[model samples]
Target chain A: MTDMYDFFNFILQIRNFVIHLQCSITLIHNNNMIEIKNLSFGYLKGHWVFNDLNLTVEQGGIYGLLGPNGQGKSTLLYLISGLLRPNEGEVTMNGTSTGLRLPSILSKIFIVPEEFTLPAITMKEYCQLNAPFYPKFSFDELSENLKAFGLDTDINMASFSMGQKKKAFLSFALACNTEILLLDEPTNGLDVTGKADFRRFIASHMNDNRTIIISTHQIHDVEKLLDHIIILGKNGLPVIDSPVSLIANKLCFEMIANGATPSQNEIFSKPTFGGNNIVSIRTDESPETEINLEMLYELAAEKPSEIKQILLNN
Target chain B: MRNNITQDKFLWSRLWMHIKREILSNMKQIRWQLALIVGVVLISEILICSNAYDNWKQNDYFYNSAFQDPAQLPILLAMVALGLFIVAIAASMTFSSLRTKAGKINQLMSVGTSAEKFWTRVLIYGVAPALFFLTSVCIIDLIRCVLVDSIMPIKAQFVIINPFIDETRVKAILLFCSFTACVSSFFTTVSVYSPKHAFLKGVCIIIALQTLGSWFLFRYGNILRPWEYHLDLAYWTALGVLTAIAVVLSVVSYIKYKETEL
Candidate 1:
């Protein structure tokens, strides 16, 4: 009887320790807006875009969804919006399943796709019709952004140029004041000035209630803005990764001029027009080493395995 | 706790914007069609009312001409078309709504425009056109009444069908709009299934069902003369079965659209 009592007390002590451990973990994670588990999807009779793809995004940071022309970056966003159904897997936002494009889920999330064709109606009318859906959407913010972007509310949507269209879409997206924002190729049509403004808008509006995911092949535009990077590649390399770790440790790409041959450990290289070849190597370096996103993409595309090994090493 | 409809409450608002824009732009695109349809329908209504008046004269013109009641056979038959026109306009709008705002909708969905919002947009896209169509039909109806001094035949006969026909005129308008809503909802699912074009699907459904129905009758009844056959029970039963089949197909199409990824 005494031994039985001791065993019960031991079990109780272990349970208390586990509970404390769980509390600490919760404190460590304060702002997680989206969490996807085993998300695998494909159209009927087609190959899967992502199989067992697991990802989690917390709030108040810029996440770059980088991939080639098509590796399902856009598809993933569609899944989150419940615009597309997954053959298998589940998407949860703040502990709720995204099924049938639930209104609560929609009010908190906004998307801006690449191609756009606006209606013949004025922008103001458009806003009036769509504003009620987003509880946090602010007209003042929309007006301010429109002014900053040099967009006139009086102009019909059909009148804007492609760059102007993108600007309008971006401005409209920001006004939604959603907790989750999805932007696909937001900077593709913008001029340099517009791109700069886009970066500024992102920096200014970020808060606990919002998380922005930008999918693009223009790594150069996002290099400075991106805090976390998920690279989608199937060239026998790592499928996803963060920019900070990629630049700070595990991978290095440097230009080696003629007369200075790189060691065999060099992950990849090819002779260039000026006789200086760019080579990638697996190494741990301080993040002070600025990342050349364009060069990185090219080198990684050339040698996906080298990048994969670097990821595995980490 | 939460029903599916409430999730994308914002979508209805957004769709309202999209619908307005589509209606404005498409109205201009179909301006010629609108003018023609209105002209033709007005002329038709006058001709039909005049023919009814002529028929009354031939029959000694004693009954009071029904003007207030919309449920009379003559008006209902003329307006049996009202709902189809409304639904056709709604379907056309839906076919173009997503394509017009493709970038915005795609991006919005990624950002968390809920599926409910998408469905709401579909509803608005379908209904906005219907409301506009109803307005146009109403104007034509008013003109017909104004030009013809005698009672519009519809105003004469509807209280005979049901005495509660006092509200029949207004109810007809509402019913026309509602019938279009249901048709467009099904059309939306059809649109999603065949994004490039739905004309063929619509044609196929109409033709195939009709052909199959006649074939079923021949195979089941096998009667060449009506007087020799007493198959009213069988005929009604067949029609009921066919209608159930159509309903089931519509429901299935809706489910397919609900789960479609794009």
Candidate 2:
């Protein structure tokens, strides 16, 4: 009987070990990946854009990088994508320094700048030239994306208007199927329908292996799609870097009725034609609400310490 | 397949693809430049040959004296100089993609080793332009031979100026080639380094450095004096030094290109 009990115990231990191994593998596959450590960068001497900035971007989320004008939102995107080298530290993707711009790292990352120039080639020719660099590029996806944007593969990009060109480029960027996608002001020149298509296309294409960072001042266009928010403070420092779920849990965003008095718990507020849009700390009884990105940005920009303290306490 | 794409090391296939892409993307501009070359060469040759014909009709002795040796012809030397200037200008435009933020981002983010990209530009701007110029001139020279032999009042063996056939022509071509290589390499490096107006900056830098080098040589070295130096020895020495500097500058250009940032 004791021997039997020992055998049963051994079997249980094996089962536990197998489970642990599986968990470890899953964790390794899906974890915080891109790490920016002690990164100091500046365009000029003694005026740092990002001084000793440290950031870690987890895989598989749509990150909205937000900041006011001239605060280095685009600069940060460039730094992360390895287009800009830091002065003091490094930005690494999967433990490899991005500044090296190794093909391994670059192939997995694609950046769509706010402004760009397409060669005078047709979309097909452009893809023929560029698609080989990205191993995971899918022609079918390119076709689908282009169709969604109301563009054709045979159209000459040089003849495209700015909006149409943006759509085409964005479509190509998505079809590259890179792990990390960086977009700066993606929706700026996009038409109303194009913006809707952009959101839909991005949503449809997102997967567990991909992480998209969209840096844009046009909050409404991307607010619904963001899984995380990163707001840069003065000197390109991030004041709020948190998941949308956590943000919703800690703060409530809502519009007060026209006659309602100002709430004491309000962290930030702005008057609207119909009512006042306010961001306030969430109480235990309060239900989670949709994030008001504009209001939230104002709160973080105005009362950074207060917002930080509130989020930290939760 | 993903592993192949992610390989950071230099691969020949990828480099070849990059070269193809670079050429195809700039195909239109290249076509325009080639047309311009043909136009310029044709017009210049016609003008020179027409003037020579008129001179020949006026006086055969003066014409023969003026065009006694094709190798010593000022027109050939001037054509070579002009070709070299064009090469330098093309070299200065090597990093034109970096002029705009968007272009810079696109280029820097493109998936290829820096060596691959740098070598592509070197081949396209540095080496290929010089070769193309040489070929274009040779072809035009052939056309000129036919035109001159057929139309000249006194045809004095109007053969093509084949550098391979004559030692003097070969030496002159080599000297000009080396000088052009040096100029192009320097201009290419400046293109990688300068923020704006790279061509102007490169020209200014060359002028300043040449002046400084001449001043130092004149002030310090008596043996380097124009009258004292042996022409052949000085010529060979200058050619060797220029070639060495060109090689060094080419390497430096690659290094600068690899480390360039937006």
Index of the highest-DockQ prediction: 2
* Model 2 misplacement above 4 A: A1-30, A261-264, B1-3, B62-72, B151-172, B225-236
Chain A TM-scores, per candidate, are: 0.79, 0.90
Interface RMSD of 1: 8.6
Instruction: Output the lDDT of residue A65, model 2.
Output: 97
Alpha carbon lDDT at A221, candidate 2: 99
**Which of the numbered candidates is closest to the native, going by highest TM-score?**
2
lDDT of 2 by residue, A115-139 (tens): 8989999999999999999999999
As for candidate 2, its clashing pairs are none
TM-score of each: 0.72, 0.89
- Each model's fnat? 0.46, 0.81
Candidate 2 chain B weakest lDDT stretch, 10 residues: B151-160
Please state every model's RMSD to the true fold in angstroms.
9.5, 9.5
Q: Give the alpha carbon lDDT tens digit for every residue of A124-185 in model 1.
A: 87776566557787899999899999999989888888898889889988998888888888
